[model samples]
Target: MTKDEFIQELEVLIRARYGVILINTLEEERALDLLTDLARKLNKRLLTWSCTRGLVMDGNTAVHPDTVDLMTAIAKAEQLAEEPSLFVWLDLQSHLNSSPVYIRRFKELAQEIRERMPSNSIIVGPLMEIPTELQKEVTIIDMPYPDLNELKMIISQFAQQYRDRNDLQIDCSESALDALGRASIGLSKTEIENCLAKSLVQHKRITGEDIDFILEEKKQNIRKSGILEYVDTEKLETADIGGLDNLKKWLEIRKKAYTPEAEQFGIGWPKGVLLVGVPGCGKSLSAKCVAASWKMPLLRLDLGRVFGMYVGSSEANIRLALSMSEAVSPSILWIDEIEKALSGLASSNQSDGGTTSRVFGTILTWMQEKKSPVFVFATANNIGSLPPELLRKGRFDEIFFVDLPNEQERAEIFRIHIKRIGRNPENFDIAKMVKLSGEASLGDGVRLTGSEIEACVNQALLEAFFVRNSEGHPEGDVTSADIERAIVQSVPLSRVRKEDIGYMRTWATDNAVRASLAPESALSSAPESPAMAEVTVGRNIDF
Candidate 1:
């Protein structure tokens, strides 16, 4: 929900005299600011307390300066003046769960406030660590990160703060402000302020150019999370991804799925897609390319890292990861090789005290019920290990099986790798590699994965690099004989894991959509002759 809607809900609960309200958030300062506003609306004085600083009126002098102990602060709160007030307790969760005496005292204090006057107590912390003893008496609210409107307000305030400074200029046109607002959606008030300050210091002004600074700040924040890894996505364009035409086509159609116009047209946000197939058939690469294709940040989630040794810690980590993903909506959450990460599903009850089972259930439930625009791009190689619940309809928009590249796709994969190394693909004899595919049985199958095709081109380049020319330099040309040799020496996973590939292929026939547009008939088609037998590579080398 939006921040304004959340504030309205909190106001209702406060007016209804909810004895104690527990808010979970990392933005302590922002929460306090919100409480001060709510206090004004309720016509009550705002009082705040911390472990170090006893009780102090909001923006006013301390009420109990000598009371440094937490118990003493609670006693003073219990004896509040007859006037209604809102008591905001900061960082009291650690003791609330550890000390029984403190718990009983806080419960009694809550009862006193509810029975005596319109005053209420609020506990704000980084997590919702409420003890079971007071769960019935306290209302828990999971505060969300700053939304677009809140971010715009933060940007406007920063601009106004520097309006008097003659050295700095703030060009906040409606369009510029909107761009900054959208870019700063996931940042907290303090982060937004700090980012804007840094931008002004570096550029002497705030404009559309400052969005990169905000994104860098987000990367730093995500790194601290530990569960989510930020990817350097500048090099991951859709053009770099080879083959998977059907998958690429599917993604292109939904490029504008998250825009305001789509929503206005009654189109809901696209849920996500699942890629299941053999290893290294462009599944994970496709996951990364989506972020670039969609112009969004990419976050990698490692489920193995989420499982903590302590009780309930694993669940907390998942909550943190998922919450942070939602905070940065219009982003991609890539779960690579998900089957291995979510393994031990059947024996979770017998082994890890059902922790894995609970964690698995939590992820599936979130995938099914999440309303945010964070797209879940999950790739799994071992379909047998995956839970049946994840395979059910609606969990993912569609399940795609990325099989081994067909005849034409293998040639395209070869061309992509050659071009990536700064050599023209037309110089290499790719048709010779395709012809070699028809000559070898390669165990039970001739299909090669995209990775194996890349290896063939790389090996051929190595061969060319070692061959010397008459000028005593390495020969510049990669020949058909070099490619043929590399293709014959390379081994495809389809040869070693024949049964596994066969089962997955059989399953894909009925349960999943194919990732490549090549028809099954195209697999047996003959190769075309190359326009040139070989192109020289030595001249293109910078050395």
Candidate 2:
């Protein structure tokens, strides 16, 4: 429950349990006034405790005493009381652990007072951990962050107040109000008010941009909580990616769901997509590119960071991080190489004595119950390492298997890299380059990732300039020869993980995962066994 709801419930509980009441909050003076008003309604003597003066404010005026012993003071006040009422206030809990005698005496006095008269004692502090013996008698409640409606009210109040002073002429449009309201979702009342005031001062008028700026500022506070890191991507786009047409199409369809128009049409926000595939086939790149395309903030979750050394701290950290992600709605949460992080959880009992298992449980619960618009995009290279619970449908919208780029995709990869390095494709013989590259041994061709191809082109360009200036080479343009030389020199991830890639391809074909590439086309292009007759398909299409 939110802070207001918690307070309202407390008020009702206080009234129903006993006619007398007491409240304690961070704002001590405000708490005193609220309790005093409740005391007036019951027509009972109200008592407060001051650490230095001892037993002050007995309904009418402040009372001073020479002794500061709270238990003794409470006893003396009860003895001198004119009306049959209870004492309620704060500031005695800190010294409870220091003095065992005082704690025992206070508990006995509290029990006796409650039994004899219609009296109740309520103690409040910043962080309260009640002793096990008194746990039954005390109620602990957590004050939650402000919700949308409360935030809207706060924005409205600020706009109205600002408009009244200095003829500010503030126009509180519904869109602007909504933006501000959402921006303040996870902030405290004081924090929201402060941010609103600062935003007004910075922009001169609160616009959507100002609202975004305020939300970015609030994101810093979320980061300070130490659960989630605010990630800033370096302009990675779908165009920079070479293949994964199915994955791209899937993402394009969901892009509209983030807009206000989709909400008007009653379309639910997209949850996220899971990319599971062979290593270096653009799974991680796709995660970053999706966030870039959606124009939302991206947060990278390093699972290792969530596992703490202290017991129970790891679980708490995970909850806090998930809470922050929810607070910053309409954002992308990227968990790269998830298999490595969660692999230990499969046999956590044998591994770390159940710490990993507990952490896994916490994440599973959050993934299922989370209501926030934070799209969770997790990429896994090793499917065998992933727990079966994560593959379930409700956890992610879809699971896409990114296999090795096909012949068509390989040509696209070449063109993308050539253009990226400011080389005119028409000037170079792309067809020969594609033919030479595709004809290479399966191990050589499959070794190339989108990133590796880009690196090859870059190296080729540097060689081209060197040959033209120093060697006075006859070849004016960067040819297939240059690219071939670079490819041979470079070692790709596929070469290093050949066995793993073969396993992934077999798994994709047999398993339930949807291929990110065209199924029929991929099957046709795949190499045939030596036993099969040599077959040739249609005319050659090159880059």
Give me the candidate number with maximum TM-score.
1
Q: How far is 83's C-alpha from truth in model 1 (Å)? A: 2.5
Q: Which 10 residues in a row give candidate 2 its minimum summed lDDT? A: 531-540
Q: Which ranges in model 2 have alpha carbons more than 4 Å from their true place?
A: 1-142, 164-169, 200-203, 256-271, 418-445, 461-482, 519-543
Q: Write the per-residue lDDT of candidate 1 for residues 1-543, one digit (tens) a residue.
A: 778888988998888888899888888999998998889988899989887778998766788776567889888887783579999998798768778999999999888877877799999887665788898889988788887777777788789877787788787677878899998877888998899889888988888778999999989988999999988777888877777777888887777778889889988777788999889789988987889878898999999999999999999999899888888778889989889977888888898999988888888989989998988999999989888899999889888888766567777877888787778878777776765653243533446677777787788877777785554665367666777788788876777887887778777777787787754345335322221111100011111
Error of 1 at 240 (Å): 1.9
Per-residue C-alpha lDDT of model 2 across residues 1-543, encoded as one tens digit per residue: 655676676666555443222233344544455456666766766776657667665645556565366766767666644344446556766766667776666666556554565455556444344555555555554444556887777678777877765534466788877877876666666666677677777766654456666666766776786766776655678897776776787788888887889989998877777788766667887877888888777888888889888766777677667766776677888888888989888678897778888888887777777767888999998988989898888888877777666556667888888888787777666655554444254344244666677777888988988888888776676776898788778776766787786676566654535444544544466542221111111111111
The 0-to-1 C-alpha lDDT of every candidate, in the order given, reads 0.80, 0.67
Q: What TM-score should be assigned to candidate 1?
A: 0.93
Measured on C-alpha atoms, candidate 1 has an lDDT of 0.80
